[model samples]
Target: MLLIAGLQWIVGPLIEYASPSLHYKYYMYVEQTQYMGFVVPAFGIFVLFVLVLIKKTALFNFQLGRLENYSNYGLVIFIIGVFFDVFGGFLPGALGFVGFILSNFKFVGAIILYYSQSKKLKKIFYVAILYLLITSISKALFHDFILWSVFFYMFWSLKNKPSIPVILTTIIAGALLALTLQTVKSAFRAEVWNDYSGNKIELFIGLMIDSVLASDTDVSQIDGDGVDSNVRLNQGWIISATLDHIPSNQNYFNGATIKDAIFASILPRFLNPNKTKAGGQENFRKFTGLELSQGTSMGISIVGEAYGNFAHVGGILFMGIWGFFLGKVWLFLYNQIRKNILIIAFIPLIFLQVIKAETELVVVLNHLVKSLIVVFLFIWFAKKYLKWDFNK
Candidate 1:
C-alpha cells in the first residue's frame, strides 16, 4: 500500500518536477504544486487508517501443509486458468469470471511455489516466474509484475528479515526497472498490437536493453504518439483534473457511482441488465467531463472518486473508512488461514486488482466481493468433497 501510493503520488511527481520535459508535458493542465496539496493529505489519511487498523502481530506467521500436493494443485489450477483465458469469451459473464480470477495463474502458481518447502520445487518456480515475465513482456502489460513483486515481498518477508541495504537495493532496482519499462512499453506495445513479423519477446528484450543503455541520452525521451507513459505513475493528474472539473462545471456524484459499484458487485450482468460496465469510461466522462479516446480507459482514483462524490472532508473521511475496511479484510483473511490453509491461495487472487490506486471503486469492489465468493465456495467445496486434508 505504501509503496504504490508513494510511487504514484510522491516519487513520480518528484521525478516530474526534476525533469523539465516531464513537468512541461504532464502538468500542463494542473500544476504539480497545486495537486500535491490534495494528493499528499489524501494519501496520509488512507495510510493512517491502514496503520491504525492493521494488527502487527497478525501480519505474518502462516501454517504449512504438504508441498507436493499443494504444488501439483497449483499447476492444475494454473492450467485450468489458461483454458479459461483461451475460451472464456464464448462463455456467459457469470461463467467467465472464473477466467478473470484465474487469469494470472502464473502469479498464483508462483505464490504456491514460494510457499513450497521442497528444494525440488525451485525449478518449477523458475519456470512459473519466467512464464510470467515473458507473457507480461509479450502483452506489453507490467501490472502483473508489480503484483508479483508484492506477493514475493510479503511471503519472503514473512520468513526472513532482510537487512536495510538489501531492502534499499531492491527498491532502487525495482524503480529503475519500472522506469525502463515505462519508457519502452509504448513502442513495444505498438509492435505487438500491430503484428510485428519478428519475434515479440525478442523485440521487447531489445527495446528494454536499448532503453537501459541509452538512459543518459535525451534521444530516448520520445514516447509513442507523443504520450508520456509516466502518466501511468501520475494518477494525481486525473485526481487533480477531477477536482478542477467537478462541482463547478458538474455537480457532485452524491454516491451514485458507489451505489452503482455495490449493485455491480452483487448482481451479475445476467441478473442486472443495466449493470455498470467494466471499462469505467462512462464514469470517467460523467465525473471528470473528459471523454477518452475509443480505446482509452482511465479511472478517477478512489481519492478522486471519493472527493467527487462527497467533497473534500467527506471524501477524506470516506477514504479513511475504505482503508480501514481493506485492513480489516486483510486481517480477516489471515485469521481464516488458521482454519483453512487453502485460503492462502486466495489471498493474492482477492487483493490482486484491489491494490491498484488508479482503478475506480466499482472495479475494486466488484473484484473484492466476487473474489470473496469464489474463495468461500472453493473452501466449502474442498472441505466437503475433495477431502484432501488442507489442515494437514
Candidate 2:
C-alpha cells in the first residue's frame, strides 16, 4: 500500500506534465509552493517508513488464527457501514437520520469493506483501477448518491489484502521516486531556490535530509497573508497556507487562541462540499482576511484556517491523534470481520479528503472519536452475540 501510495504521489505530477496541454489550466491553479512541495514528499516518505517499521514490529505479530478471526469481524463491520452509507444517501435527511441511529445504537457499524482474500496482483490492480475509474466517472456524472456509493466501494477495496507481485511493487516504487524527482526538478526550474522566492521546497527537503539544517529567515518572509499582490493563488499558495499554520512554538494541546481554534474545528466541514457559494471569493477574503481568488486557493485557505487556528505542532498533533484512533478502529475491525472481503470498502472514505486541500483537524477528530465509540460498541455486541473470547 505504501509503495502504491508513493507511486500515486509521484505519478500525479507526471500525469500533469505528460499531458501539459490538458493540465495547463489545472496547473495554473495549483501553486506547488516550495514549502509544501518539500513537506508533502517528506511526509510521504515518513509515512512509508513508519508503515514499514510497523510491519516489522513484533507488537503486531498476531498468530495466523487470531488474524483470521479479526478479519472475520472486520467483514461484519464493513457490511453495516455499507448499509449506513446507502440508507443515509437515499433517505431524506439521511445524514441526520443516520446520526440519530448511530447515537441511539452506539455502534460504529461497518464502514466500507475490503477483499483481502485476493492473491492475484493483476486482479487487485485491475480492481483498484476499475474502482477509481468508476468512482471518478460516477462523481462526474451523478452528483450525490452514486458518488457516495463510490466511496463505499472504494473503502471495501482498500481493506482487502492481496499478495502484491514483486514486479508491480517495484514499478510502483520506481514510479513514485521518479515523480518525486520530477517535482524537485520542476521546483528548481521555477527558481524555487532563490532567496526572495522563500526557497521552502529546498529548505524542507534539506531539513528532511538533515534534521539539524537551519533555514534562512527569508523563507519565513514569504507573505502568509493573501494580501501580497505577487503571490498567485495556486497549489503552491495552498501548500504554503498549510505549512505556515503549523504552530512550531508551542505544544499542540496548550498553544492556541479561542478564535483560531474555533475556525480550525469548523472550516473543513463547511467546505467539504465542493460547490461554490455566491460571492464566495469575497466571502472567503472577508472571513479569512486573505486575498485569495476561487479555484484551489479556496481549498488551500481551509488549510490556512487550520494553521491559523493551531500552528504546526497543533496540526501534527491533530493528524497524529486522528491516525492513532483510526488505526485502533482498523485493528478492532480486522479482529472481528469474517472474511477479508470487506477491507476495500473503507479506502474511498479514508482518501476522499485527499484532493480537498483542507485539513480540518477538529472536525475530523470529532467525527473519528464518535466513529470509534460506535465501532467499539458494534464489536462488543458481535463478541457477545457470537460468544467469542479474546484470549485464545
Candidate 3:
C-alpha cells in the first residue's frame, strides 16, 4: 500500500512538474542547491509523524465481515458528494445548484443506508450507473475512473479473494494503458519514449542532491513582493510561450535545475510571504496547447525526484522509509475505521480527494483534521453504544 501510494504521488509530480522543458531549463539551472532532496525528506518525516499518532491512538483493530452485510452506505453517499462537487464546479448557475443538491443528497442518503441491510448492492449499482452516465457525457469520468480503480484495487486486495472478474479487469487495464499511450503520442506529435535519454538515472540523482542542499538555506531575508513578482514572471512566461508553439520535448533532465533555482533565488523571499493575487484559470487559458491531460507526472518521476535530490541510493532509502511508515499508519487507520460507517465514509473521501488533487498544505491539512474528528466521533459512538473498550 505504501509503495502504491508513493508511486502515485511521485508519478503525478514528475509528469506535471518535471517534464523535459522544465527539467533542462529550470531544474538544471539550479541543480547545485539540491533543493528537492530536503523537501522529500521533510515530507517523509511528516508522514512518519502521522503514522506514530495513529499507533499511539490504538486505531489498528479491524475485521472484514461478509461483504453483503458489511456494506458502507455512508461511503456511497460521500462518493456521490464528490461527484456532485466536481459536476457542480463545471456547470453554470442554477443547473449547478441542482447538480450539487442531487449529488449531496445521494451521498448523504447512501451513508444513512450503509448500516441498514436494505438492498445495498442494488442502490450502489444504480448510483454507479448514474455516475458513469454523467461522467461519460461530460468527459470527466476517465480521470475519476483511474483514481477510483486504485482505491477499488486496494479494497479488493484487502478482502483476500479473487475470481474471473479480477483477471478481466487486469486485461482491460492493459488495453487502456496502450490506448492512452497511443493517444498521447498522436496529440503531442512526438514519440513519447524517444525523448528519455539514458541519462535520466544520473540526472535524477543530481537533482535530489541539489534539492536537499538548497532546502538548507535560510529564507528570512527576502520580502513577499519579490517572491510574488518572481512567481508571476516565471509562471507567466512559461504559460505564454507554451501556448504559442509546441516546444520540442528534447530535454528531460531539467527538473533538478529548476528545483535548485527555486531554493536559491525564490525560497528566501517566501518564508512568511502574503498570498499573491494569481489566477490559475488565466494561466491555464494562456498555456492551452496539445498537452496531455494526464500531464508528465507518473511512475519514474517519483523515483527521479528522489534521485534528483539525494542521489540514487539515498532516494531509494528515503522512499523505503516513507513507504514503511505510511504503510504502518494506514494499517492503523484501517483497523480503527473499518466498521465505523461515518468515519470510514468521510475519511476515505478526504483521502481520495487529496490523492486525486495532489493537494498541499492548508487544504490537505484541513481535510486531515476533519477526518480525524470523524474518527474520534466514531470511537466515542462505539464506546457509548457498542461498549468497545478503548483501553483494551
Residues 1-392, candidate 2, lDDT per residue (tens digit)?
23333333334434433444332123422344544454354444446444543453335422333333333454445345445544655555314433533432201122311223423422433443344334433232212223344444333333443345844674476445333332233233334324334544444355333322324342223222212111221333334433433333322223233233345334443454432222235223433334654343343323243344455445444434433444555555455443332322333343333323232333333344434454456546766898645443
Q: How big is the RMSD of model 1?
A: 2.8
Global lDDT of model 3: 0.39
Is 1 or 3 the stronger prediction by TM-score? 1
Number of the predicted model whose TM-score against the real structure is largest: 1
Which RMSD values do the candidates have, in order?
2.8, 14.8, 16.4
lDDT, candidate 3, 277-314, per-residue tens = 11122122222222323343211123333333344355
lDDT of 1: 0.73
Candidates, ranked, lDDT: 1, 3, 2
Model 1 lowest lDDT segment of ten: 20-29
RMSD of 2: 14.8
Residues 1-392 of candidate 1 have per-residue lDDT tens digits of: 66777787677666666663444334524577766666677778889888877767355656543334577666655666676667767877666776677565555666666666677654565666677687787677878866776576666655466888988988899788877787887878888889788888788878888877774454245346454656667766667778788888899989998899999999887898888877778888877777788988888778889989988778878888888988888778767877766567667788877878788898999989888887688667756887656655
CA lDDT of 353 in candidate 1?
A: 70
TM-score, one value per model: 0.89, 0.42, 0.43
Each candidate structure's count of clashing pairs: 0, 56, 43
Candidate 3 wrongly placed segments (more than 4 Å): 1-5, 8-29, 52-61, 66-142, 163-342, 369-392
lDDT by candidate, in order shown:
0.73, 0.37, 0.39
